[model samples]
Target: MFRRFVAIVAFVALAAALTLVAWPQLLGLQRAPVLALAVSFRGAAAAAALAVAVVLTAVGLVLHRLRRGLGVLALLLVAFAAAEAGVLVVRGVGAPDVPVAQADDVTVLSWNTLGDSVPAQVVARAAAENRATVVALPETTEGRARQVADLLARQGSTYTVFSRSQQAGIPARSTSVLVSTALGRYREVTADGDTVGVPSVVLDPAGGQNAPRIVAVHTTAPYDLDPATWRSDLRWVAARCSERNVLIAGDFNATIDHLDGLGPAPGRLRTCRDAALATGNAAVGTWPTSMPALIGTPIDHVLATPNWRFTGFRVLSDDDAAGSDHRPVLARLRPAG
Candidate 1:
């Protein structure tokens, strides 16, 4: 019976496809083509699979001859949705309240300004409110960076600001950093290497103040840039983590799922560990304010070398109306030593 053979083949193919979507790392396809895109938004994928299952179940009830096979496929889809949802729950969809910065603690804030669509004043206010000692602004230009520094200074928080761009005077091409003088003065410096599509700001401590090297990151999104370029940018961001005593933060454009095998244990990048995962909110997404926090992509992050310990971390979704498509991420850390 050709019909029976066709049904068997269809079932096998659908199962295989769902398996890859459920866990691409099963085939090491997490970083590969379609799988990479599918895994980027686990919550969304689960919702999609569940919707399809519901539709299939309705159709199966109406068409008697196809009922059995359709019901089986529907069941398989429900299983896939459950599997994906389970991962999010395990990763944690909500973060608990984090303590505010105290003496000897450094608070870091990262916000992609969407090429300055979000004003400098809003960014300054968030930084001040968080008592952030270091701020990373991706998709923000030099001019806006200076404005943020000035606003913070007026609020009695003086910072040394540095920004870099793939091209001069282009907001979307730039990334910026502001380091509080509380830590010590810092200066803009060359990265060990370069990102292919956008700029990331790197800083070195002046006079060896024991301040960690910092990178304000901005790797291009995988869907927006060519695969090679996206991979190249991620590599550059990872390389930034390889140095000792470093603080890296901002829109990395890739999740821990994609970063697997690119680093060591509990590691999100090289020797650095993700603050969100360590603090139990790794599943809370930061991008696409249009999407729910639990359903969007958590491509933004704050990560640090082994020498630092995360005291607290959270993704701020309350600012979804703040003009940027991205939600800001905040983290507090203190020296392990």
Candidate 2:
């Protein structure tokens, strides 16, 4: 009876661990009471597993001399499982770097111009006012992208880079990069696959001087429910920015823990938060121009590379802006060691 009880407990513990890994989304959907309990003791899952391993090992040694080897093996398995669980905890509690700018500091702004009669003007106004060195406009038609680019250029812009299409794989949806005259001109890198469902622009800021490489992208929406899609988009971005001092900015439909009511799950794949945290930069939330009832689901973002530094950031929601459903966000940062 004692051995049977131990076996049952061991099975339950092992099953729980697998469930956490396979259905994290489901875990996020739990009710408040249970959810709080689950999150408050997330380590319990791993601890239970370890405890089972130790118990089973002890039982093996006590029950039969022939099982002594199995007992040792069980102990080793416990150690391995504990280590894996610890690594995930570390990953969740991310420790991102926060570097300082050297000399080539650049400011960037990214917004999803909801198009036509939305709030494009407000975003544009903010960008102009902020004097952002790099700007990314996702979900933009080629014609409108040119229109905005031209408007900014009239103010004496030097370089504007954008795809003529709105589709990602084919380089549509018009991801544009407009640089000030001081930054000089750059060559556009050819985009390869449908990996990034949105058109992304890569800017090599190397104007005889070492400027940080900037890639601007817009990701697929409803990203919270779609890991495969989100992963594909991120991998595409990673591929595009495989090298150099990189800074990625755009309407990445996600948010950080800085906002309340948002959860562990929402915070995990939040493109903006993850990107900024991964690169060790501070970011401001930008989204929901209509300011829906939630008022807290920040879905847009700007993220810098690990070597880059974040000085400041903000969101613009002036009623004067037009052409989008999202507020524009401006960020200032510099490259570091």
> How does each model score on lDDT?
0.87, 0.53
Query: Candidate 1 on 1-337: residue-level lDDT in tens?
Result: 9999999999999999999988888888777776777888988989998999999999998999889998999899899999988988877777658786668898999999999988888999999888999999999988999999999999899998888888876789988888999988788777376677888888888877888998888887777423767887887888888788999998988887888877875347899899988888888899899999888989998999989999889898777898999999999999897
Alpha-carbon runs more than 4 Å astray in model 1: 224-226
lDDT of 2 by residue, 136-255 (tens): 776666565566666777777544655535554432355655555566756555655533455666666545656666666776543343345644565465455445456677765533
> Lowest lDDT 10-mer window, candidate 2?
257-266
Structural similarity to truth (TM-score) of each candidate: 0.96, 0.57
lDDT of 2 at 74: 66
What are the per-model numbers of colliding residue pairs?
0, 18
Q: Which one is best on lDDT?
A: 1
TM-score quality measure for candidate 2:
0.57
lDDT of residue 218 for candidate 1: 89
